[model samples]
Target: MTNLTIIQQSPDPEQVAERSRTRRSIADKIRGMGQNRIGALLLLLATVVAILWANFATASYEAFWETHLTIGVGDLQLDFTLHAIVNDALMAIFFFTVGLEVRREFAIGELTSWSRALVPVIAAVAGLALPALLFVLVAMGSGYKNAWGIVISTDTAFLVGALALIGPRVPGRLRVFLLALAVVDDIGALSIIAIVYTANFTPLPLAVAAVGLVGVYFTRYLPSGRGPVYATLSIIVWLAFLASGVHPTLAGVAIALLVPVYRPDRRDVEHALELARTFRQSPNSEYARAAANSLRESISINERLQSAYAPYVAYVILPLFALANAGVVLSPEVLQGAVVSSLTWGIVAGLVAGKLIGVFGSAALMKITGMGEFGPGLTLDRIAGGAALCGIGFTISLFIVDLAIDDPLAQNEARVGVLAASVIAFILATIIFRISDAMHTDVDPGQTLLRPVDPKRDHIFGSPDAPFTIVEYGDFQCGFCLKASGSIHEVYEELGDRLRYVWRHAPLTQYHPNALAGAEASEAASLQGRFFEFERGLFTDQEHQRPSDIVRLARDLGLDVDRFERDLTAPEVTGRVQDDMLDAEAMGITSVPTLFVNGRRHTGPYDAQSLIRALSEGPPEATPEPQHPGG
Candidate 1:
């Protein structure tokens, strides 16, 4: 079963219950600890309080986040308000996650292979350019004309969830279409954040941020092969940019480049597996044991070296971020202002109109231009209908609005615009999805969160209740896999119980000469729950196969290499590795480090930073925001 247990240390429940009602009060508040409505409501309350303070309270909103405080860093005096601190400092972590997500998608997920990614890339580029053009056209000479780039974003989580709420009536194409369009929209929004939203740059901070960006250029080739270190460094760079007055979120894009992007070696994999097999199938003699022990040690080392730094950003950070920023206060004034604001109109119009123009126009233009055509069973009406639904830019838009305009009027209007347009687009998309279903006569799937479905039922992977699955496939000799030991530790810290990664053998025959034997060694570790340790050994070493490497790594990680070796080359265990290789080959895998979350393929040469992002995005769209309290 998937690990869905809510944390037992549910917080001081009785205290909150006294402050509110019972069902809606206590349980709600407890639920709020991890981002249910209570948490969002609390955040909303805080934001409202800030607004009240700014507009009416004895203290001002400026006072809440902007209270000037002086601190020392060597001889430099660092002065910033509480607001700037969060926006400039804390927000960098948020951007780091973004960088992780983008990196993974480009390397493996939706964008890695062009055959699968072209549609979205093309759509994203088009979606971005058109919205800016349309916004400029719509506002021509209006008062809030500077916010054109903000109009193109699509909040993936909100839109996709809404799409699921109404179910199959929305066609598969609609969801994929939205994903492509939204991802494209995200790239566009980031560009805008980088170029237009930030403050007048200070040279020192700008230089720092630049230096950080430069680090990313070489991150894919870092010698440490550690994902978390990369993530941490990425954050520092982001802070530098933020301190320099650049919008903090651009840091997410900046950090993504720093992650290592190498695939597993094939020859190393084959060499390791061959020795492992000979040891496993040999008679129960002294020579057999020695052979097994010798081969096992080598395999163990390779696994350990490759596993660190893989999980932190995927669970704790991303989920927490969603909760912190999704809250919005709803009031008559907020509504009235949004109704009158040009920023609101531009976004609403741009998403509603620009999306249609961009998506439909591009699809039609592509078809007519003879560059593209709908896959077998799609129609223009369905395509345009899906296009119209692409106006759901809630999450990314909200993030940008905070960065672009600090004014209360502009912020709320943008929120209202996102909320309104997203709702309308969702409804329109849902209706169109259902219409498409009728035409296709597909089966109807019921909606049930946290409920298990048959694995074959097309519902296992996205369920909140799905088991924490960990997947690993490695070569016995691959060094990068050997280095992943640190990455996995970070993932465990952030996710605790909600994470499950599975291991699969993907010993490539081309390199890592001992790769297959290494796969067998790790499987044997599973017999004693020491697979984690065995994996640690593989990824840490970059050097070629050494007989004592695995044993040494196992000892360091606290495993009995004697028993570990016995199992590592055990006949059935070795057979299991062989079986996995066959299975991976059947699935069209062309590389050594192939990974799958649930069953979907991992697309990139993942470091911890990128893998974590892919895992947390779940079924949520390319972009996600936390659910706020009221609306």
Candidate 2:
């Protein structure tokens, strides 16, 4: 009886619901923060404060940033002004996060293949070249034609934040496209900074920096103490770059590129799970430590470092950089000079007009030539708006102004241009997006399925000639979908051959980062004639749909793992998932676990009883005719 009493009772349903709601609220807040909206606002506020301080207390504003600080150990010493510290040291970390993103995207994210990479790559190159060209064309007489680098790169944080603030109807695909383009743009900018901007090249320190980068690369193999090893090596590389007269910030990029990034390994995750079970049963410190280490090791260090550093880079370093660098005395005389200044107008035109024309024009040309294509729902008008937003070149634009221009007054003019261009770009993008949304309202509003059931294309269970059909649009990471899966199983059991169930992909990527990947993985499995088997495995272990987990599931299902891996990124497989997403978008189906009975959308509860009742009602009257594949 005492042993029975020791057993844990099931949690109260109300408590469970309340806890779930709390978790969702927390998750939503975290997602919002991840979107960089708060960070962008803070950056804007910092710029305003800097401008006001520069205007009101010019002496103090300049003095505070210029105040010198020294650090030494024995005979060796280094000295820097407060401004240099912020620009050189703090900004290195910022660049490191960018490098991590570049590495991840190239490795496993959107830019993994040439086909997937072409659209952004072409657009980014044009975006970079056109801005610089326009700047040179405008600033030639200003004797700052060489300062073309100022407008060549987009501030991704601001771009994303601005897009969020604009509140586009469906921004997911466009956002992904813009981020990919930004990554390429960053690579180009970093290259220019290293080559074109580096006036002095000291071979010895650069050699030392290479050695340090090599050391950092090998640190991945270190069984333990990898973190400290990476930190020490990174510092050495940074100091080497500083000594070599190649910007120390590039050291961040170099080190980050060398860091290993990959999806979690199945073996490591299994080991972590085992340790977790042990810790749960024994409740001991040894098992706890082992479990934690295993869990950490399962995820690549690149991803871990990104999670650790991204928030600081976004919320703290960027805003601080703005506060340090954006100070400019905007007196009437200065403002009047800026109004007629060719250098100022050059930056304005290059960023606002050049970026808009370059990115959109290149993408349009690519689409016309069949060289590349935009993702579904990312129409030309939307692309134009995103390109306009890319013109918000605030952070890197100002950084380059300091590097390219020597005169304080000239820097002020350039700063004024960047500020004005960003504002104009924001307003322009907002108007464009609003107009685009107004022009492209959904026709059916998700009342009925957009695509009819094609047994050849869609994954289906039971007979194709079944009298009742239930189609579900779901994300693997959605808890509601997981619950609905249970209800769906019960309905399948009750109805059997009478019901033909279809599974469609509708991954809520903003909330569930792994959902799209999971959808693709299922499609990959479908290529091997094991779609339902993989689907069952995914629904059963919805919490573990990482790349490694998906691979392991494929192996467990007796599918050809190599083929499955190959198919996972195959164009057709990805396109299939994208098709479902496109249909979902067209039909205005935003939420997951959405069910369609026959050809009509099912509303209300999705329990087994409710689903069965809906299925029995048959197809609704005047349902939209499903189009043929590719129609």
Q: Candidate 1 on 280-313: residue-level lDDT in tens?
A: 7775576565555444444322132222212232
lDDT of 2 by residue, 1-631 (tens): 0011111233234322321110121112125435489889989999999999999999999999999999999889999999999999999999999999999888877687687789999999999999999999998999899899999999988998888889467676677789889999999999998888886788899999999888998888889988888989999999999999999999999989988898765467678888999999999889999999999998899999999998898889999999998988899989999999999999999999999999999999988888875555667889999999989999989888888899999999999999999999999999999998888665444677767898877788988877778888887877777776677777778767777889988777766767878898999888889988888898888788877788889999999998887787676787668667766765667576677887888765556765665666543343322222110
Against the true structure, candidate 1 reaches a TM-score of: 0.52
TM-score of each: 0.52, 0.83
For residue 52, model 2's alpha carbon misses the true position, in angstroms, by 0.5
Model 1 C-alpha lDDT versus the unseen true structure:
0.54
For TM-score, the strongest prediction is: 2
Instruction: Give the lowest summed-lDDT range of ten residues in model 2.
Output: 20-29
Residue pairs clashing, model 2: none
Each candidate: RMSD: 19.3, 8.9
Positional deviation of residue 223's Cα in model 2 after best superposition, in angstroms? 0.8
How many pairs of residues collide in each model? 99, 0
